[model samples]
Target: MNRFALNHATTKFWDQREAVEACARIGAGIGLWREPVAAAGLAATAALVRDAGVAVTSLCRGGFFTGGDRAAIEDNRRAIEEAAVLGAPELVLVCGGLPDRDTGIDTARARVAEALAELAPYAGEAGVRLAIEPLHPMFASDRCVVSTLEQAVELAAPFPAETVGVVVDTYHVWWDPRVFDAIASAAGRISSFQVADWVTPLPAGVLTGRGQLGDGCVDFRRFKTAVDAAGYTGPIEVELFNDVLWSRPGPEVFAETVERFARHVA
Candidate 1:
């Protein structure tokens, strides 16, 4: 059977302890998140997951290459350190949007390149791989400027295979016409594969209104087969950020997510 994992942000409504416990009880073996890990106290959360036999698939985010300032760079470097503390295998990088809040897409791309040059080496040394997560083009203004699998691969081209790679999330790049080609090109370099459905017309641009498994247009089985063909045998993590799921009890949401993941992708 295909393994199902949860992104911590999907269960942000719950405290870290509750979310971790719920995932453990429901047979979930992977987790992806950043802030909650800090708040949960790295050692405590690591021990909890360890006790429950859960796997920390990848951390939520570490890159925000815009701002063009020292502070932002330092913050991201700290994030890499935190990933080491928690025994996470990958640090998801949502490279920043336009620089200084006024730059264009070209400037954002340049900034990300510069930041990655500095950060990737450091992260690689710590035994942590950096997974560059391309945000949807809808987020090109305030979130990640790297908005496609091809773009992400290009950005990671200069780095060693172990130092940089891409996180292929369905919600972000499913609509791209070149998705199949990108996925094929991404063989052996896909650091993570996140699952989420893209719903239409979101009011707020950031915190997802992502659809549930089988509720939206993403063809998970097809994606799984492609990734498997690419030799990426990692966990296919379910990463939703829906208001409706957030309002429910943590355990209920976790169990439902696991069941739906099996029904749709298995």
Candidate 2:
């Protein structure tokens, strides 16, 4: 059986309390969002998940290098600290894109590398691995400068294995022509594998139209096969941010995610 998990963004309709309950009840792990963690109080959120015996797959987001400013870097560092406190194994980084008014992807990538160099040592000491999430090219303008697995791997070259890695999310990377080869190249360093489907007609430029599993273009079985072949033995987490799913009750969404995991991914 595939080990299914939930990214907290999918349950945006629920408060932290409900999110935890859903995960615990369904034997699912969680990928947490920074806002919910802050709102619930990091310590309290950590304790709640622990008390419910749920595993946290990854902490959703730490990087915003495009800001290329002191404040953004500090915020990223704090995210690492929060991940450590929660016992999260990986800190998923959606490295920011161009600074306000910029339009080049190349410059943004250079900034990401610089910021990664700064945080790697600190993240290593925190016992947390920085999982760089390569957002889809659609977000190249404002969300993440890193948009391909090859680029993501190259970006982690300067960091040690324990300090840095990459996350392979189907929603973000499914369209990459080199995805198969990249996964093979990633080998043991693919820190997290998040699953979600891609939808057309993006609501806005900021990446908000993620599709539910089996509801869109993603082929989870093939993707999971690739991850497994690459020796990634971690959980395949479901992470979606669709307005429709977000408007539904937490329990209903939880049930559908698990059903899809079994029907399609397994």
Candidate 3:
């Protein structure tokens, strides 16, 4: 079997506790979200993971510091603590978009760097690495300004390699021609590898349009090989945000993801 994982967002309506239990049954790891973890109560969820013997591959998110807001930073701090308690080694960072008043992508990206410099040490102390995830350029204005792997790696450069790293999420990056080169150069700084496909005729607003594996144009096998060659020896997380997938049962989605990984990614 492949080193596959189900990022909780892929099965948005699934009960977090049941997801953990299902992962345990199949010896697959899981990527969790802070909201669910908090809703279930951190201590209780931590105990659930421990009892189930399911690995917490990585935490969903812990970044949004583009606006230099103290609240965002503080929220990330708590996310780090939660990851540590749950035995997750890294907290994925979805650096936020431009502030309503701001218009420059450069300035927004700089804010991300400043935030990382300030938080990296704290994360190191808390035993969690920050994984900077760059979203597609289409989301530059309202979701994330960091639009490529190169940019994400650059933002992570100043910090200690272990304390700050980049997440190579294929869905946001498959269109980049130099993607493999960037992946090769990331080397040890690659903290996470997530996979999802891109389909055309995007859903309204496009946020939840991610395609299931093998159902779109993404070259999953190619991405898998590139990350492996880049020395990423971690779980390959499936994180589709498709509404169609969410309409089905979580167990069914999980099984489909596994089969798709075997056929298209392994």
lDDT of each: 0.82, 0.86, 0.91
Q: How high a TM-score does candidate 1 get? A: 0.94
Candidate 3 lDDT score relative to the true structure: 0.91
lDDT, candidate 2, 28-70, per-residue tens: 7888988989988999999999999888889988888887788
TM-score of each model, in listed order: 0.94, 0.96, 0.98
Candidate 2 local lDDT, residue 211? 88
Most TM-score-accurate candidate: 3
Q: Which 10 consecutive residues of model 3 have the lowest summed lDDT?
A: 99-108
Please provide, for model 3 over 131-166, each residue's C-alpha lDDT reduced to its tens digit, 9 standing for 90 to 100: 999899999888899899998888888888899999
The count of residue-pair clashes in candidate 2 stands at: 0
TM-score between candidate 2 and the true structure:
0.96
